[model samples]
Target: MRDLQADLAICEAATPGPIQMKPCACGRCNQFLLSITHADGRFDPENAKFIVEAREGWPEAIQRALKAEAEVVTLTNQLYNCGKAVFERDQARQERDNAEDKVDRLEDELRMLQDALNQRYQP
Candidate 1:
């Protein structure tokens, strides 16, 4: 199988502007064609580095692949964010539990000190 991207890259490097497609007009059978041309749609056969015959449905397949790739990227980002949020929530819960434990210890110490003072001053 031919590497479409590599072929496109070579054509792009050899020419200026974006790649364009049009129906072949070389007196041959009706077929779609690919070529690099300037924005004004000017094509020079002498400077043409390469011309590819685009098979039917090739363009649509490329578009679908591009859309699928974009969706994959978006889903990957969302997964990462969800993992981060879970980690942060667990960390916050741990910190709150530790704080509560410290408060309980302080309250117990305060009660003991009050009892000691009362006994010392009792008749």
Candidate 2:
């Protein structure tokens, strides 16, 4: 599986803006085709022609892609930091529990020894 962070980093570093658009015409029908040229120089669906559903979506798609990429990056960082904090907290809790268990064991031994001494003195 491709890492999204790496892909986004590469995209942001290499291509810093929206994909270019070129107004083209259909070869067979001589009809106008709205073409979207990506930063990678690849045309959008070369086989299928776009009839310009909405010019708004062209730029909107770019903005959405950029926004989505940023959101993913932010969420990924949050998840990593949260996971590390949870692991640290769990480790600290385990250590405290282990220490308490050791102290309880020592206290029980001391109580046993004191009780034996008291019985001997009474008798």
Candidate 3:
């Protein structure tokens, strides 16, 4: 039960291409996690340990969370703009083709009219 458009909006709303991120060892925040055991250079699935130093400055953590929320919003906006532009471009192309078809029809009609005039005036 996931909204597909909302999912795609995450990237289109952000930028033209995919989002890039720097890899982290053990997925540890440097400000947090004084030490990480095993040094796997990646997040450990089984032997993961996160030791909280202190909870004195929860506001800073909250701010970090909000920053992540802002990133999501920015990404969604990018996707929305990209999708809109694509839609508009498609519409424009369709309109142009329709106009071209109309011009072709008019040209054919003019040719028919010229042929009729010639037949009527021919000796």
Candidate 4:
């Protein structure tokens, strides 16, 4: 895919007024900000039906924007994983606590039965 810089250059070269009014390839009106060549032999900028100023800033600006977007996506993924881990840990802890409580109750019942037997047989 063409880097943002190449795409921006195409936008800058196109006629500003017509390009602004023209519909993008996606059928959306002027939604395409830039275009660049792709590896699949697609995204041809030569036959672009629109016109815009070909500025030198196109590449740099697009690169920065892409980097920022990647960072945001990474951060979102990290937060989701962290939340899942915390939930799992809490569930495990609760299960352990419940098992301990059951064992304590069972032990108390056994001790009470032994004491009653001893008192009855003492005579």
Candidate 5:
């Protein structure tokens, strides 16, 4: 919400020039502006997608908002990946510990059996 308002403010600050007609990626003939609005602009997450008309300053604002949104999404993905890695590491450590304990128990049983056989043969 804050980001939307900030981008709008940037658009409002720019001169209200003519809207430039351009080809949008959505295969539409769209008008673009590079303008900013005031600090007290109305808020909407989808504000970047909707231009009030073909104003000069609005295009730049929209671009900034889109870029910021992308960055936020990337950071969120990184955070989730980091958490998953930590969980995997912990699971691996627990498995290794369990295996080591089993090896120790088996070695102890083998030693006891060997001692009993030696005592019987020597006597």
Candidate 6:
């Protein structure tokens, strides 16, 4: 399984700003560009720290992947909880059986002692 916590940590540590997509204005073939803008709306394409080429369907694909990851995390946690619950239930059942067996043995001992006393008194 992928480490969900690590992925969350990475996202938390990423650039604290909004991502922007702008059209390439070099008068060349039509293309789109991507960049992370600071909180104050400052952007520098020439000195961008990180840049990614925007391809058709890339954004949608990324969104789908994120949704899938979230679902995986939720399902994995539920599965772990279910397994733990089953183990606890089994443990409780074993303890109950042990207690019932102990009670039966004690009852048998009491009956034996009672019978012996009755025989002695009759004699």
- For model 3, residues 1-123, the per-residue Cα lDDT tens digits are 333344344324432323234444556664322132334344332222211211322345567669889999999999999999999999999999999999999999999999999999999
Residue 47 CA displacement from its true place in model 6, Å: 27
lDDT of 6 at 109: 96
Better of 2 and 6 by TM-score: 6
Clashes of each: 0, 0, 10, 10, 17, 0
- Expressed as tens digits, the lDDT of each residue in 60-114 for candidate 6 is 5577789999999999999999999999999999999999999999999999999
Which parts of model 3 are misplaced by more than 4 Å? Answer: 1-52, 56-60
Candidate with better lDDT, 4 vs 5: 5
Q: Estimate each model's TM-score.
A: 0.54, 0.51, 0.52, 0.51, 0.52, 0.53
lDDT for each candidate structure: 0.71, 0.62, 0.58, 0.63, 0.64, 0.67
Q: TM-score of the candidate numbered 6?
A: 0.53
lDDT of 4 by residue, 56-104 (tens): 3445567777998999999999999999999999999999999999999
lDDT of each residue in 1-123, candidate 1, tens digit only = 456676566555555647567776667768656565554555565335444323423564587779899999999999999999999999999999999999999999999999999999999
What RMSD, rounded to one decimal, does every model reach? 7.0, 11.1, 16.5, 12.0, 11.4, 8.3
State the local distance difference test value for candidate 4: 0.63
Candidate 3, residue 50: Cα displacement in angstroms equals 8.3
| lDDT for residue 32 in candidate 2, whole number 0-100 | 37
- How many clashing residue pairs, candidate 6? 0
Which of 5 and 6 is the better model by TM-score? 6
